[model samples]
Target: METAFIESPLGITKIVGDEKGISEISVLSEGTVSKKIPPQLKECVSQLKEYFNGQRNQFDFKLNPQGTDFQQKVWQELLNIPFGKTISYLDLSKKIGDVKAIRAVASANGRNPLWIVVPCHRVIGTDGSLTGYAGGLWRKKWLLEHESPSQQQSLF
Candidate 1:
């Protein structure tokens, strides 16, 4: 798999993928930005730039995240969530047709490897609290604020 890193408002964004499809995208507290993006990752990098610029709402690139069938199902359901909307973990479990799987749904959400592309950040605690983001709660808050249509200022 080819890899590249790009600077994002929250941190250095790492992207990993190849001809099959993008398999991973994650944020780091610090890292060197790639001087050149791989040919396979060019489109994804461009779309990510548009996303961070607020010029795009939905991502249409191919995704090849590695996970179990249950996790894959949960991730697919996550794609149904709109760009500027948030859903409770309980709601997500119900949407997946298993209210009792709320904990499992939340666990899969936390393991989402595609970061902003998969939009795991849109899932929250049943109480509407921002919770359990692998990228750190602060970054999750920043992403939510960034996606808020009525947002008037940057969290920074």
Candidate 2:
């Protein structure tokens, strides 16, 4: 696999993949931005940049996130959530066809390897509260606010 890094609003972002398609993309603590991006990962980087810039709402690059079959299914369902939208974990579990699997679904959602691209940040508590995120709750709030179409702009 190959890797690269870029600065983002949340922090430094790491991207890892190979020719088969991007397998992993994550947000990490501040780190050195990569000087050279692998050819196989350029599109992933570009798309992520577009996403952060609010220029793009959908990702088209091929994805190859690694996970168990059940986790993959949950992640795939996460992809179905529209950009700028949020869903409760209970709702997500129901969408995945197992109302009783909320905890399991949430576990799989937490294990999603693709960060913003797979949109695990869109999942929240049934009470509409922001919940667990490997990237941190502040980053989760930032991502959701970043994607919110009706956000207010500074009066400056």
Candidate 3:
């Protein structure tokens, strides 16, 4: 697998993949950005830049995240969530056909390897509270606010 790092508002983002498809996209608190992007990962890099710039809402690139069947099912369901929307973990479990699997769903969500692309940050606690995020809660908040279509702009 080829790897490349790019700077993002939240931090340095790492992308890994090849012609088979992108297998991983993760964020780091600190890292060096790639001076040259791999040919195979150019589309992903471009799409992500558009996403961060608020020019794109959905990702259409191929994803090859590694996970169990259950986790894969959960991640697929995560894609159904609208771009500017949030869903509770309980709701996610129910959508996956197992309300009792809330914890499992949460665990899988936390393990999602494709950060913003997979949109794990869109999942929240049942109380509508921002909950667990592997990238840190603050980054989650920033992402949510960034994606909020009705968000306010600075008066300046």
Candidate 4:
């Protein structure tokens, strides 16, 4: 696996993967921007840049996240969620066809390794509050706000 780091609105973002496909993309508290990205990681990095710049909505990179069959199923279902939309953990469980698996679904969502690519940040509390995020709740809020189409116009 090859790894590269890039600066993002949330902080240093780490990308790890290889020829098979991208396996992980996570946030770091501190890291220098990668000087040289591996060929396999170039497209993923580009897409991420476009995403942060609000030039892209959906990612089309080849992903190969590591997880159990059930977790993979949940992640696949997560991909069905449209961009700029949020879903509660209970809603996610029901969509995955097992309302009782709410805890398990949330656990898997928390374990999502692909970060923005997988969009686990789109999950929220049923009460409309931001919830657990591997990258921190603040980063979750940042992502949601970044994706929101309506931003306060600069009056200056």
Q: What value of lDDT does candidate 2 attain over all alpha carbons?
A: 0.93
* Clashes per candidate, residues 3 or more apart or on different chains: 0, 0, 0, 0
Give the alpha carbon lDDT tens digit for every residue of 34-92 in model 4. Answer: 89999999999999999988788899889999999989998998898778899999999
lDDT, residue 8, candidate 4 = 93
**Per-residue lDDT over 38-108 for candidate 2, one digit per residue giving the tens place of the 0 to 100 score:** 99999999989998887889999999998899999999999999999999999999999999999999899
Question: Where is model 3 more than 4 Å wrong at Cα?
Answer: 152-156
TM of each candidate vs. truth: 0.95, 0.95, 0.96, 0.95
TM-score, cand. 2: 0.95
True lDDT of residue 41, candidate 2 = 97
What tens-digit string does per-residue lDDT give for candidate 3 at 1-156? 999999999999999999989999999999999999999899999999999988899998989999999999999999998988999999999999999999999999999989998889999998889988999999999999999977635556
For residue 22, give model 4's deviation from the true position in Å.
0.3
* Stretches of model 2 off by over 4 angstroms after superposition: 152-156
After superposition, the stretches of candidate 1 with alpha carbons farther than 4 Å from their true spots are: 152-156
How well does candidate 3 score on lDDT at residue 110?
94
**RMSD (Å) per prediction:** 2.6, 1.7, 1.6, 1.8
Q: What's the C-alpha lDDT at position 33 in model 3?
A: 96
Better of 1 and 4 by TM-score: 1
